[model samples]
Structures are given as C-alpha cells and as structure tokens.
Target: MAILSASDRDAAAYPIQSLFVPFPLVCFTLALATDIAFWQSGNVMWQNFSAWLLFAGLVFGALAIVAGLMDLLRPRTRPLRPPFLSSLLYLVILSLALANSLVHAGDGWTAVIPYGLALSAVTFFLCLVAAAVSARKYARLAWRI
Candidate 1:
C-alpha cells in the first residue's frame, strides 16, 4: 500500500476541489459577520477585517473553481464530476462572492467621517452571529460600500 502525500494526490483518488470547498464558505461567512460588526459598532476595524476576509474568500473560491474544472475535464474524474446544474450554481456563487468582494474592497478610508476609517485589531470578537441570520443576499443588496 503506497502512501499518498499532499503533493502526490489527484482528483480521481480524491476530488481536488473538495479540499477547497470549506475555505470559501468559512471566509465568506466570516466576511458577512465582520460586515455586520462594522455596521453595528461603526468600527473601521471590522470593515477592514471584512475586506480581508472577502479577499481570502474570493481567492479560495477561484482556486476551487479552477480545481473543479480541472477535475471535471480530466477523463478519470468525468463520471464522478458534479452535475452541470450544481457546477453552474457553484460558478454563480463565486460570481456573487466576487461582487461581494468588490463591495468589501472600497471604503477603508472614510470620506464622510473625515477621520479615516482604518484598522484596529484589538477590537474584534469571534463574532460569528450574522452567519445564521441569513440576510446577506447579493441580488437584493444595495450597491454601496
């Protein structure tokens, strides 16, 4: 029985994209939480945190998409690949996340307050509440930073 290291792995043995699924979920969910915190406390730090989280989520989500495509393209994994609708859904979510990333990308420096909305790491809790509230829908959201 040969042992497989992380670098020796392939999609047929284990779906490459499976390794990446949890990351976008975690990052995007946390970004939503930080967005809420920034709104609730008027904290620039939370906004910064949310921006970084969104960036990470987008990166991971992109990787997952690439891995999924590679997996699906390979003949060995063809039969095991996810259905077309599910793949389309995944792409849709990634696009939404990309837009969400754009939402988080702006407004680090305050144009309104004039004091500059910046960062403060000491001012955060785990603060995972908004993940359950389920109100961060992209289509219905207003397009503002």
Candidate 2:
C-alpha cells in the first residue's frame, strides 16, 4: 500500500477550499483598476465597465464569503484562519462600497464616487492580505501534517 504525503492528504481534503478567497480578491483588484482607468480616460465605456466590475465584485465576493464560511464550518478545516475574519471584513466593506457606488451611479452624485472608490480600495488590500495569510497558513499546516 502506498502512503499519501501530508500535503497530498491536505489537498485531497480541502480540494478547492483555498480558491474561494481569491475570487473576491481578484474581482476587487479588477474593479479598482477599471475605476482608475475610467477616471483617467473619462470615457463612458470605462465608466460603465467600472460599474459592472463593482457589481460583479459584489456577486463574486458574496459567493466567496459563502464558500469561505462553508470551509470554516467544515470539520477538518482550521478554526482560526486569518482569511476567515479578513474575508468577513472584506464582504462588509465591499457591500458598503457597492451600495455607495450604486447610489452615486444612479443619481450622478460625484461625491459618493470618491468615497466608494476609497472603500473598495481598502477592501481590495484587505482581501489581498487575507488571501496571502490564508495560503501561508494552509501551507504551514499541510507541511506539519
């Protein structure tokens, strides 16, 4: 009988568990990038793209949160992964940002756009940090086990 390596075992158990957080992280990054481009070019298409990105980020972020929560609730998962808390925070921040963006976009309120962009940027950084931390934790745990 062949024995599975610790890393292999961990991978088998977790499968795509870690991939969940990256979805929102990437989405937010793209959203921020699109927003910046739109601001620079002052193009209607880029503005529309930025808005779409924000909405898409919200959808993906919500899904990522659900997936992360499910992973956290699993019996074999780590109970104290930093990504879990960070992801939760990311969700809240992104939701607020999305709301602000929607209102601003709908009413052509310029003031809300800055605030929304700022909030989204903060959440984007948080998601990046969380994803890195979570990956590191999983790697360490897998190596140990």
Candidate 3:
C-alpha cells in the first residue's frame, strides 16, 4: 500500500461494500465444492457444511448490497459505487443461492444429486459470468464484489 499524504486521504479510498465482497464469493464457491463432496461421499456432514456456507453467503451478500446501496445514494461516494447493473447481478446471484439453500433443505441423496447440486452449479456459473461482466471488478459475484 502506498503511504497516503494528508491531502490524499480522500483519494484511493474504497467503498465499504467492496470490503465485504470476498466473503460471499468464497462462501458460495465453497458451498459448491461441499456439494460435490456430499455427492461423492454421501456424507450428511457435507450437506450440513453446505447449509452453513450458504447461510453465511446470504448474510454477507445482503450486507454487501446494503453497503453498496448506501454508497450509491451518497453524493460523494456515488461515483465510486458500483453500477446498478452490477447490483442487479448481485441480487440475481443471491436469489440463486437462496434457492439452492432451499433445495439443500431436502432429505438425503435426492436433496442433492439432481436439484441441490444443480443449483450450486448454476450459482457458481452465474458468479463467474458476473465477474466476467464486471471485467473482474470486485462488485457483483463480480463473485459478490
């Protein structure tokens, strides 16, 4: 990090929302991996892991959206905030994760194989797409940026 001169304190500052971006991305991505592990080992433990991860992702993702919105609405920070399209994409990513969490709420193998796993895959894919769309900026799944 560069040493900030007193006059430059206002410069190179990041949005508070950007600081929360990595949590959801890591959580959701790990949830997908745990889903695969559940599929492979048929372990109830993996499913439980996924449940917690999804929940964590939801929590952090919500915080990120709120922070982003706060930044966007602030006159001084508006220009530094993410675009509406970026926020929209983050919402979609969260929606998919919420649906995936619901799917994982089911019982046994059926809970995962066709549906839960599918949802996880879809969510992961959406994250990748959003990241790509944002030119890999930390803002939407842009993996939760």
User: Whole-model Cα lDDT per candidate?
Assistant: 0.57, 0.62, 0.82
**Per-residue lDDT over 43-138 for candidate 3, one digit per residue giving the tens place of the 0 to 100 score:** 899999999999999999999988887777656555466656766778898999999999888889888889889889888888877766655454
Error of 2 at 60 (Å): 1.7
Model 2: how far residue 76 lies from native, Å: 2.9
TM per candidate comes to: 0.62, 0.70, 0.82
Error of 2 at 78 (Å): 4.4
**Model with the higher lDDT, candidate 1 or 3:** 3
How many clashes in each structure? Answer: 0, 0, 3
Top of the candidates by lDDT: 3
Candidate 2 residue pairs that clash: none
Once fitted onto the true fold, the runs of candidate 1 whose alpha carbons sit more than 4 angstroms away are: 1-12, 108-145
Show model 3 residue runs off by greater than 4 Å: 1-10, 136-145
Q: Tell me the tens digit of each residue's lDDT in model 2 across 1-25.
A: 9899966565556523356556656
Over the stretch 10-46, how does candidate 1's per-residue lDDT look in tens digits?
4325558868866877876676667667666887888
Which residue pairs show backbone clashes in model 1? none
Question: Least accurate stretch of 10 residues (summed lDDT) in model 1?
Answer: 118-127
